[model samples]
Structures are given as structure tokens and as C-alpha cells.
Target: MTETFHEFVVQRSPALSRTAYLLTGDHQLAEDLVQTALARTYRHWRRIRDGDPEAYVRRVMYHQQVSWWRRRRLAERLEAEPTERAGGDHTDTTALRLTLTAALRHLTPRQRAVIVLRYYEDRTEAQVADLLGCSLGTVKRHAHDALRRLRAVAPDLLDATAERSTR
Candidate 1:
């Protein structure tokens, strides 16, 4: 039996939010992206009920984010106040995540999206190209450029082992 839109959202939102967060690199923007995507999905739910609604919503979010990025070429505003968190012992992981996030911010929106989809989402180049409505060559170029930029911006985060082996 097919699930209701609300049920589908409840089941899928957390994962979607994580993807959105990775794409936007800001909690608030991620929330907005998910919300906007869900809203659009809700509108088309009846028609898409029998199909892959989640994929539809994700595509909407991607396109919407890219549109927003194109329209606003201004620098992304960082959070003014850091939220308090329950202390954890994962300092190394936290530091690495922060470093990666900073490096991603240096990339263009399309490049960042390519990295997030290709690496974070673990999608193949063809899958990413399909999702982003771009060609395979475009995806490859973006991935190459994004990695090069990441290497320049945060060499430490790319591959410590490879760097060590070269040295």
C-alpha cells in the first residue's frame, strides 16, 4: 500500500534534512530547503503518490537551491551565535567536519552540489548528472574542479595517507 504524504515525510525527512544540510552547509538554510521541497511535494503528492516522491522532492530542493544560489551571489552569512551542544568526545571528527565545511564553502554552488551528490550522497556520476539534469561531462568537470579546489583550500582534509605516501 502506498503511504500518505504526511507518512512519507515523517519517514523520510530526517534523511532529506541531512542531505539538505550538506548541500547548504547551514542548518537554517537546510531546514528551509527541506521545507520548500516538502511543500512542493505536498502540492504534487496526488499525482506522484504511486511513484518516487522522495526523488521528486530531492530534485526540487536541488533545483531550488541552485536557483537561489544563482540569484544571490553574495557571500553566505555565517551564524552569529553558535548553538550550545551536549558535549561529546568526537573532537577530531568535529574538527574534520568543520574543515570540510569551510572548504565546501569556497566552491561554487554547482561545484559544491556536485561534491555533495557524488561523494556525500554516494551517487555515481551518471546518477548525479541525471538528478541535476546535467550531462555526464558536466558532472565530471564539476567533480574535478571541486576536488582541485578542495585540494588547494584544505589539502589536509583530502587524503592524508596519499600526501604522506608522496612525501
Candidate 2:
């Protein structure tokens, strides 16, 4: 609620939004995640203002996402696409985007979190473990399984050697 907090929100909201989208794989859910995280951050502004508030917000978002995953039954039917393109990453082709999205859909919440935190956020395995509050071995296991599933679902995503010049 302070001026600095407002500035922090303005500065970090875009990156937070992108990460939220990657985490939820749904635009509306991502927006809600970011909003909830920011609200939590605001509540703890006095305590975390001197520290890395963004990290705190991200941690909150991740925890909230897990709880949401728990509440929602995984048996829900799959839709062709969750939402229109988030329009955040223009470099990736639509085919690759859709394939990756579908591939991600095949993963559990933890596996998806590992993949997103490690690759999209460029977090180290140890960091991912810490973020998810799991052992390093668990993080590695989730990552391995997630990649295996990604490979089975969308092999092209794993084969980086191929040239994808969609020009």
C-alpha cells in the first residue's frame, strides 16, 4: 500500500504475469494468480519490503497454484486449447506453442511446475527444489518424468537439433 509497493507492482507485474501464465497455462487463471500474489505481497509489504518481495510473491503464487491443483479434479475433460494465444511470446511459432501447451497438459501439477520453473524461469534444479519445498531428488524425478512425458506427447519439443525456421 506504500508508494514503493505500488512502484514494485508496476515494475514487476509484467514478468509476474508471464510466469503466472506459464504456471497456470490459462490466461484467466494466470491473471487471478498474479492478482492474488500481489495482494498477498501487499499484506506483507512492511515485512518483505527490504527483502526480495518478488520472490516472496512468486512463492505465494506457486503455493496457491498447488492448492488450486489439489482442489480441481484432474479428471476434468481436456479442451482443444485453454485460451487464445497469451500473446506474450511472439518468437515461438503457433504450432510449437500449441504443441507445448498440449504436452504440458499431460503433466501433473508438480511436473509442470518443475518444467516451468527450471526452463521457463531458468531456475536451477536446487532452486526448483527449494521453490517447491521438495528434495532435490524429487525435483530431478519430476523433471525427468516431465521431460519423458513431453517427449512422448510432443517429440519435436525435445528434438532441439531440428531447424524450425517458420519463415
Highest lDDT against the true fold, candidate: 1
Pairs of colliding residues, candidate 2: none
Q: Over 4 Å off in model 2, which ranges? A: 73-77, 80-92, 160-167
Worst 10 residues of 1 by lDDT: 74-83
User: lDDT for each of the candidates?
Assistant: 0.84, 0.83
For 1-167, candidate 2 gives per-residue lDDT tens digits of 58999999999999999888877777788899999999988998999999989989988898888888898832333576545656656555766776687778788878888998999999999998898899999999999999888888777775532656433
How many pairs of residues collide in model 1?
A: 0
Model 2 residue 129 distance off true place after TM-score fit, in angstroms: 1.1
